[model samples]
Target: MGIEIIHRPLRTKNALWLPDRNLIVVKERMRSVHTRCSIAHELGHVHYGHVDDRPKHEVQADRFAAENLIDFAEIRDHLGWIGHPQLLAAELGVTHRLLRTYINVHRLAS
Candidate 1:
């Protein structure tokens, strides 16, 4: 699908996807990494054909974004050992919260 990305002010969420319209609306003021992850997550929703707004779907989308955006093997190779979550997230160009979620979802020790 040719999804069009639109950057604008969103009241509640950082980004949302309209599957019917093939559009993704993102908050313009969001940080670049957040924006990228948000878009990736939304794209996951689209790719997975998720129409229900359920917690499981959201988790799946988040996992998809984390898996695709942050390569675990690459990060591990580069960092060797991750002592701090913030440092690892910063090195991976992702939010600490997202990194934690990724770790939890993948059952990886941080």
Candidate 2:
């Protein structure tokens, strides 16, 4: 992909893709798992050739990141023990939003 990744202080955004430079910029001060997910999300945007950050494009990227970060088998294994979403997301080392996206995809697959 030849995409370069860099960390910066983005006050409002976790990560974003620069199509012109083929670069992915991630927030510098986030947690480790969050940083990884953000990078993955930006990579998703690059993979889909999204030139702009629109809602539809965001959803696509989120789905891509979630699918890549979360394993369905692990989700299933954790479902019985993890009753709260926050805990589940924590256990999975992902954000709640990513966990939700993973759940939506999981439902469709099932």
- Measured by TM-score, the strongest candidate is 2
The weakest ten consecutive residues by lDDT in model 1 span 74-83
Report the backbone clash tally of model 1: 0
Could you tell me every candidate's TM-score relative to the true structure?
Answer: 0.88, 0.92
lDDT (10s digit) by residue, model 2, range 58-102? 999999999899988888888764558888888888988898898
lDDT digits (tens) for residues 10-102 of candidate 1:
999888888778899999898998998899889889889987658999888888888888887866675554667787888888877678778
lDDT of each: 0.83, 0.88
Screening candidate 1 with a backbone cut-off below 3 angstroms (N, C-alpha, C), the clashing residue pairs are none
* Cα RMSD for candidates in order: 1.7, 2.1
Candidate 2 residue-wise lDDT at 66: 97
Which whole-number lDDT from 0 to 100 does residue 81 have in model 1? 43
Question: Candidate 2 clash total?
Answer: 0
Clashing pairs in 2: none
Q: Estimate candidate 2's alpha-carbon lDDT, on a 0 to 1 scale.
A: 0.88
